[model samples]
Target: MSAIPVKSKIDRDQLLKISPFKEVIKPTVPHKHADYFELILLEQGGGYHVIDDQRYEVLPPTVYFMKPGQTHCWDFSRIPKGYVILFREELLTRECLDVAYNLPVNITLNDVETLPGLTRQFCDDYRAGASPAILKAYLQLIVLKTGEEARTQSAEGRFTPLYYQFRSLVNEHFHQVRKIQAYANMLHIPAAQLNLICKSASGKTPSMLLNERIVLEAKTLLSNTDLSIKEITDVLDFSDPSNFVKFFKLYTSFTPKQYREMAIARLH
Candidate 1:
């Protein structure tokens, strides 16, 4: 018998054009993507989905979201039928959607059954040749539902605008600003206030979050590129190679060389 193929799909541009009707794939296996977000609704069958470091059982009427850069894999011992939507971050802008991006990163459909009819309606509408404007409207509605569910079910507080601003700044300047005060200065907020906002929203201080984001980027570079640590440090503007090494160790408990070795081992 032929081995089952691991099918991986990624779209980093506009929202993917997808069929709203249920899709069935048999004997599919595990896969991962580097950049893309996926929303999956399972209509039938049993399997498992691994997102990041967590695994979840797959059952009928199940829903899940997978963010970019996270690894996900699914079991296919039994064929599964479902509607899957793939979209990019740019598809929904914070300015356009009023901070929809602040919604929780993941959700389960079973917990939010109050909207199955609405979700089904959306699928039906899309399948029935809905216009792009209609589809976008439906998508925003879905996001709003998810956000409401998250707010009701999650113990974490909603992301404040200050926290959102800090996250955006980190995304834009993580390579350039290594200190919490630098970001606070850029935002014209006191360092202590920034820390308070980040802590209230994400349970981490601004400096910790900033360092963690930088470390994540550094790990990606170390794993995917052939650049030397010195070159990577220069690109990330760490002032010196030694400072970069110290920063990486402080956040990751691994020196640059050790982290690279571990990453190379995993690839092999």
Candidate 2:
């Protein structure tokens, strides 16, 4: 717990920070951003990012939207070249209507050349003490562009609303319910239908998505708190710590103790 930096120190007001990925000096440890939105634009990189339950390859020309309370870890093979645009929802002047933006979604921004100019300008303006209005306009532009990209994926995009709802259900109930069928029942759909919905929208089955969400929450607790394994099992409503260990190892390849140690080492 002393090793993983908890997000208890975040300020109350909405905040925004922009920095080049290569210049960041902090450890890229597995952690949760509990109080703000994260917008990361990648131009060049190859690595793995575990966001929530699913794992994503850190491919170039991609933008990832990470909502508040999501846990993410980056293990880039090389120093990634990109911009990390972080902000709180309060920073924006207008409300964004993209339903998918409320959750985490990674969209491929194909025009790689275009992102650099905006990111560089934003950083420059930020460092030179530019007006809040100008800085926010840049943030809005990136969000709008990413939303357009999400919408361009045909019928797949049409399935986003349902997918988001299902995911939200999983996020909210994952601590207490681990069964995919249970989630389907809550969503008022058959288990098989729910699986198909997730597959169509995310290329991953509902079971995998649900498992990942549970694993993420477990990992967060293990890393950020001083609670013992038994206490964590109780928090997650597991039958016992042994059962919890088995489930954690199934997705993470590390038992709770091992995962916590490794994360603490990296963060330290």
Best by lDDT: 2
lDDT of 1 by residue, 119-228 (tens): 67777887888888888777666666766655544555557667766776786677666788888898899999998888887798887888777776677667656788
Worst 10 residues of 2 by lDDT: 1-10
- TM-scores for all candidates: the values are 0.61, 0.60
What TM value does model 2 have? 0.60
lDDT of 1 at 127: 80
Whole-model Cα lDDT per candidate? 0.65, 0.72
lDDT of each residue in 1-268, candidate 2, tens digit only: 2223446324666477887776332336666666577778887778777675456887778888887668777777766777788787666533352433443467777676666677878888888988888888888776766766666642343445556668767766777777888888887888898888889877889888888777777877776668899988888788999999999998988999999898678556
Where does model 2 exceed 4 Å of error?
Answer: 1-5, 8-11, 23-27, 93-104, 153-216, 219-229, 237-268
lDDT score of model 2?
Answer: 0.72
* Candidate 1 colliding pairs: none
